[model samples]
Target: MNFVKRAGMSLRARKSRTAALLGIFVVICALLLGGFLLRSAAEGREAAAQRAIGVDVTVRKKGMSAADAGRLGALDVVHRYNPRFPVRAGADGFAALTSRRPAPGGARAGGGGPLAVVGVRDAGLLLPFSYGSTGITSGRGITPADAGRHVAMVEERLAAENGLKVGDTLRVRSTAGTRTVPVEIVGIFADPTRDPTGAAPPHELPGNVLYVPVRTARQLGSPGTTGEAVYRVGSPDQAERLHAAADTLLGAGSFDFRVNDKAYRDQVRPIQRVGAFASLIVLVIAVAGALVLGLLVMSQIRERRDELGVLLSLGERKWKLVGQHAVEVAALALPAVAVAAVAGQLAGPAAGAALPGGGSQHRRAAAADGVDATVPPPDPRVEPADVARVAGVGLGISLVATVVPGIGILRLHPRSILADTE
Candidate 1:
């Protein structure tokens, strides 16, 4: 019989051994499927986080030390800055005044409340972008033109609660000193979560925040120190090198900073642990499965010592015998790998659905500043289509797993089988 026919016959004759080897191949394919899915999911989550933060790096004071925070503002790469101050309620503090129309009998108006204030030197840099849900909800954003105009931008919530609107005037008193400034509400916005990091989001109809130019904020005696140094890199990969260079130039611990790279920070220790553990486990599993498969195939070869002897005596070359066995294993293992890959793909969506806030019916509009601390929606990470691509890769791994053992079969000299005289 020809080499092809001989290979087919060998596969058919050793049903039990072939089945055992196929089982091992199945396990290896499964490991690859799981690892790829998790890896894709993690990448998606980090991408979402970066989008929300807007900038690639953030430098803040390590603690509540405003002095240290201000020092960061002096860095060469520092592009923007904000200084926070306290806004309180009193004669010179934040005050709300209500007006009662002219009545023959009486009229009344008043305002008072504790308030939190943030001071900014560069309003343009403070809100680099306009971030809001459904576009600008009210008046225009804060600008340098309003620097000394005593103008303020108020979120929708703050406006409604205080019965204030665009063109309305309110008082902001300084907590440190008895200084009050009357500022007009130039704009109303809608971000419930307003992050001090940057422009706040306007997801909710009314945001609970307010803004004023740096000049007006400083007048309130809440002049905070400068600010931490910050940077915006082009890509995540660039973050690491840039951070290292920055440290070299700025000096370690001189300023507090944050970079988006997965390495360098201990905060991502859990994710690192998971990835490291997964890699180690996958490696061990792959090798163990391959060994089990090799053993089964080797055992089958031993059992067919007599059959192999006859084939060798008939002038069959060593490569021909090795090729025949390899083809048989490929036929079984390749299909198993394909099936596993498809299954993994299909299962990915279901897994994503199980993630936290996954498939949430309510879409929360994110602010430009608030970081996306949660993982990204899982479906985008590993779609069903990815399964086919991964399966193809798994097939290559499976092929290598199977073919490697066949080398031993090739090394066997025909003389050895004939020496047995079977």
Candidate 2:
């Protein structure tokens, strides 16, 4: 009979032994598949977090003139540039408001103060609104049409305190009280910030915050008061490119550029640690699988010593005998590997979901940075590539485990093998 036929007959005759090896392979393949899927999922989450956090550069300095703003805005690396003008402004109705409680040193109540008045090019795309830390609760946000006009978006609490509503005109006085602008309330937004830490005066609380058009802010404040210019780069990778371009265009020492990616970094650290641990698990599983399967194959060879001796006596080539053993093991392991692939697909998502801190830490960090915490995280699913990788590893494991022990057949002398069996 051909070596292939004889190998098939041997496997058939040793039904219990073949079944035992198949069971071991099924367990090994399942572990390998699970580890690969988890590592891939963790990496996927890290990328998603980075994309969500976005990349931006803030230039903080005095004397960032309109010409500098125009130059930075015109850079190829800038997706959008928001030139901010922040001033302290007291609204007409809320000036008398004071915190309900007095301070520790008998300081006046918190309520009577000027709030931060921020002027922006686009109220909708401002960092706080864009990230969802603050959302419009009534009416609409400021638009380009509102530029140069005394339009504003007030916090919901502030509006309630002043009996203000959309379309109501708010009288805002600059910090110096030198000029007062009548800003029509175009919108009211919900503030995500909690109550003021006792450290902040009442006027500095979330209720006092307001958003106005940049032109109007310029009109109310000093003629040349310029705040930070924030440039949004498309990705973290492009942050440095934009910074360099801005530095060259604005002159080396004109201003300082700083990248804000702390939120992304904080969110990704835990996921990366999880991925590293998953990788270690994969390595251990592969090594242990090889050793366990190798020993099993070796024991099977010992039990079939008499049969192998008979075949060698019949002039069967040692290589052909090894090939026959390999085919039998591969045939058994292939089916188990296929089943493991299916099992992994079903189990991968559940395992990834169970991974601790995948979403919670990210949400907390996002909330701290005024990012919307309600956005759902990416779901973990086993992709086709994951299946292919698991299958390849499983087959390699099977070959190494079976072929290494099958080589022992070469050293067995036909006469000695038959005599030892006897």
Candidate 3:
């Protein structure tokens, strides 16, 4: 029989040893596959987290204008921006919510208690809207396209108080009463905050606020200016470009640009740790797996000394004897790798679950980014390339295991083997 055939027959005849070897290889491949899947998932989650909560650079100055915001927003380093100009305005057709506690110093509020008009290029870019603390209950938010339009997004409670809905128009007068701004309602949002205690003014009440286009606020006595310009950038490093650009545009010492990466840091750090741990697992498993297989192969070779002597004495080439053992080990590796690939789908989730923290913080951070997520993040999954990687590693381990033991026994002659058998 050919050496390959003899190896197959030998494996078939020794069913228990073959099963044991198959089990060992299966375990090794499974562990390696799990590590690869985990690492890939961690990297993917980290990228998503970064996108969700990227760095924000806030620009504030003594007197900033929308024109300044436009120039800075056009920079390549800036992703999105909102220039806020919150000003007080008197409204018709609705009552602004006021605290029952008397107005501070008892100076009566004018025009049914004036409401705050927050002028912005985009309403959704506001911090309250970005965080889940406030959400649009109906219609859509004011976008950049609504910059010069007279559109407004009111609080849901204020909308309910006036029975107002989208498409309804409200008449607003400037605090100075010099300009009258007509705005059509576009959205209604839900806010959890209520009027505070201790004689707060009506305009200071949480519900007595509406979002309008910057042009509307400008028309209603606002300066079309902002203390801070909210900017979204991909990374903290990208903020440096924004800083230099702002310094050139607004002039150094005229404005301050501060980068806030708290959300990105909070969410991405844990995933990075998990990714590092996964790499460690792959390295340790690969090294320890080779060592274990080498020892096992050596023990099996020692037990088969008599068989080896007979094969050598019967005119079998010494290299064939070594090749037979190599073939047996190699055959076990293929099936073991195939089994691990199939089993990886079932095992991947458990491995991901074993990760510390388990995505609760990630979910909360995503929620704060305006996503009302109901389900948890996806679990780790084995990819096709991961199977290929584990297969290659398993084969390499088999080669090391077989070649080392075969070389050791091949150095001894058949006469020495028979002498040992006696």
By lDDT, the best candidate is: 3
Q: Which ten residues in a row have the lowest lDDT in candidate 1?
A: 197-206
Per-residue lDDT over 149-198 for candidate 1, one digit per residue giving the tens place of the 0 to 100 score: 88877766567656778998877666554667888887776654433342
Q: Give the alpha carbon lDDT tens digit for every residue of 1-422 in model 2.
A: 78888878888998988888889888987888788878888877666654555566778778677567768777776666687777666666545344555577876643323677788766755777766678898999877677668898888887877788999988888767777788888899998888665555655677777889888777667536465777766456678787777678767777787777765556556677888999999999988988898898798888888888998999988888788877787777678878888888788768778564456765676778754344344465667777677777777877888789988998989999988874
The whole-model lDDT of each prediction reads 0.54, 0.75, 0.81
Best by TM-score: 3
Query: Mind giving the per-residue lDDT tens digits that candidate 3 earns over 15-80?
Result: 999999999999999999988988887877666555656677778986787788889999987778
Q: Rank the candidate models, highest TM-score first.
A: 3, 2, 1
Candidate 2: RMSD over Cα atoms?
A: 6.9
After superposition, the stretches of candidate 1 with alpha carbons farther than 4 Å from their true spots are: 1-5, 12-20, 50-151, 155-162, 166-210, 213-267, 349-374, 380-422
Candidate 1 local distance difference test against the native: 0.54
* Candidate 3 local distance difference test against the native: 0.81
**Deviating ranges (above 4 Å) for candidate 2:** 54-57, 65-82, 85-117, 121-152, 156-186, 190-226, 231-254, 257-262, 358-369
Better of 1 and 2 by lDDT: 2
TM-score of each: 0.56, 0.70, 0.76
